[model samples]
Target: MNIEKFDSRFEILPIKEIIDENPTTKTFVFEYPLGGKPGQFIMMWIPGVDEKPMSVAFDDGKEFWVTVCKVGPASEALHLMKVGDLVGVRGPLGTHYNWGNGDHLALVAGGYGAAPMYFVAREAVKRGCKVEFFIGARSKDLLLYVDKISKLEGVNLHISTNDGSEGRQGFVTVLLDEVLAEGNCDVVFTCGPEVMMKAVGEVADKHNVASYMSMEKYMKCGIGVCGQCAVDDTGELVCKQGPVMDWKYLKKLPEMGKYHRDAQGTKHYF
Candidate 1:
């Protein structure tokens, strides 16, 4: 028998800076670029804490940033670090969103998902595509990237908060529905919570709009050797084949929004 193995060759780089987006979230900036595209993620190692995959929030050709939300031990450790701290970075790995020739694009984002979606919107608008951003959070305080996305010249921003403290009282999906009714979107892109992505997928399907979503999976080996991020029916690895997949293809995935397997492959309901 023969076997193959390889190392990720992670790089330890110093943090350029950190900007607090809110209490729970902060944007970590690094003076490095792996030529990441929108929707692609990098394995970020916090040394003694742990490593995790984080989506690229901002990449300006010279540097890149990842928006981290301190939800657990590893991330909380990162939250405590200062500007000059060192962290290991592995890749701009996984497939990214495919940009086609579309004039009008609609992006639906919830929670920290705005990071990657904002990246997409930035790149898209730069290519002359008019973007409409539908963003939602639990309340006004939790919404990510509102100020950043609003500054883009031709992009229109619509916001929603669960507590009715923002643009709309319900979900961002309501804005999606309204945008679809206006019949102007050529493509719809969404990221954030699984439930929000699932609902966005359904609405896109109903409106016959081409849609793409970034999936969140419990990734072990970010390069896909561990098989921990496999989507049940498709047998596709999120760390390898996606994080970003078309809505049409994802609708056929039985384990998409229903349940996802843990690191041990135990099914857990979302």
Candidate 2:
């Protein structure tokens, strides 16, 4: 679809509900019927604060949710706001994770990436796909969606933390590698930090499992018009062509896990 559609335009809506996921993170709910799919994101505008891309955690015809971690200015401002505060939403844009083609799914998440991955897992299990979810965080306190993900049936949850506060003490990738070694997964799905996604993508590629990754990049216009989010070498615009792409295409982009551009095209290495 193109950006000329009405849904691509911003609709200011008040926060209907807010659920605290952690001390520093909360999920904002709105009553809009976005009908968005997993891996697509919404550009959330926090009044005076700039609009930023956010993964749509859940959307079920009547209400939509966005789980935000208080990391940047826009998110910090959002955390300070209360219920009924107005915010602009203009998305469910970008590509979504692949489905229906696989029976057993492996989902990997890191930090706030857990939200988007949970969105996918919810749909995956519903489609009769057995899911193995791997969640990684610096510590238990920093993790997102552990309780919510655990409660879902047909999902085998695996967790890793650097501090050993919750699960195994190591990179979450280690858990994924171990699972892949056992050889039952049909596809791999992931969303999180670029570095972790890169490693996960490599693992999926190694196991010869088809993988879909929800990518992240600095963006302005959610459509392809903006040149701000183009991938180096390949020149694929993250906002238009991706945010979720297959491993075959993702491996072609030289900037996958290395660095990203800012609003002004400044390179920031990850």
Candidate 3:
């Protein structure tokens, strides 16, 4: 395992291609090879619009992808850019998921969380680990990366949609319960909404299985300076110390799902 470092300098990279993942989401394939570890993120800047952190959706040494969901002005600007357009990228930053722990791994993904989880699944499979994916979405239209993940060599995918339009009709955590009960999970990796991750953490705790998750917070500096994304309990910066942490550590955090601070350090309900 090699630790990656960037000079804190930004790179202006051109977008090579774009794939519409859904009505509101798009995947941008970059012209440069950003060999980022799974769960690491890049700071994307759109000139005067805004800059935000996006998880590395796919990275295969030669090419990488950033999956963006149109939620705000910054992401909307990125969605409107043309193929040849260039965007300012400042990282492959932060900690990443670790592999080589166990042979059986369970992935719990909800909504766009599948993006980084897809990256994790790809690398895990190449190491000959058996991956059982539990993907959940609000409905069929919101699901992402199903085609790509299903095509992987050895992956057992179980899906659930809130409306019963996909696999079992329930939250993804429900499927995780079944997998953990079968005594098949060695480690769990999840990325999704904070509420969902908290629930997954609880379940993993009940089974005494090791689980890890990617956390999302309002970030301004992307590096550890502004203190905008610090947890209320430990004051740990998600941009520097984490974004990925173990379930045992995360479950004890007072700010895990209850509240998060904004750029002005205003606390808001999660």
Q: What lDDT score belongs to each candidate, Candidate 1 first?
A: 0.90, 0.90, 0.90
**Residue 206 of model 3, lDDT score:** 86
lDDT of model 2, residue 145: 96
Model 3 / residue 167 / CA error / Å? 1.0
Writing each residue's lDDT as its tens digit, candidate 1 over 1-270 gives 656665588889999899999989999999986789999999999998889999999788789999999899999999999999999999889888877655799999999999999999899988888999999999999999999998997799999999999889988898899889899888898998888899999998889999999999999888979999988787889898898988888888888788887769899998
Q: Which segments of candidate 1 are over 4 A away from where they belong?
A: 1-7
Give RMSD to native, each candidate.
2.1, 1.9, 2.7
Q: Write the per-residue lDDT of candidate 3 for residues 210-261, one digit (tens) a residue.
A: 8999989999988998888887688888999778987777778888889887
Q: Residue 244's C-alpha lDDT in candidate 1? A: 91
For 1-270, candidate 2 gives per-residue lDDT tens digits of 566635466899999999999989999999999888999998888898889989999888899999999998889999998999999998889899877834899999999999989988888888888999999999999999999999998999999999999999999989999999899999999988888988998998888888888888889887788889899988879898888988788887878788999889999998
The residue-level lDDT of candidate 3 at 22 comes to 96
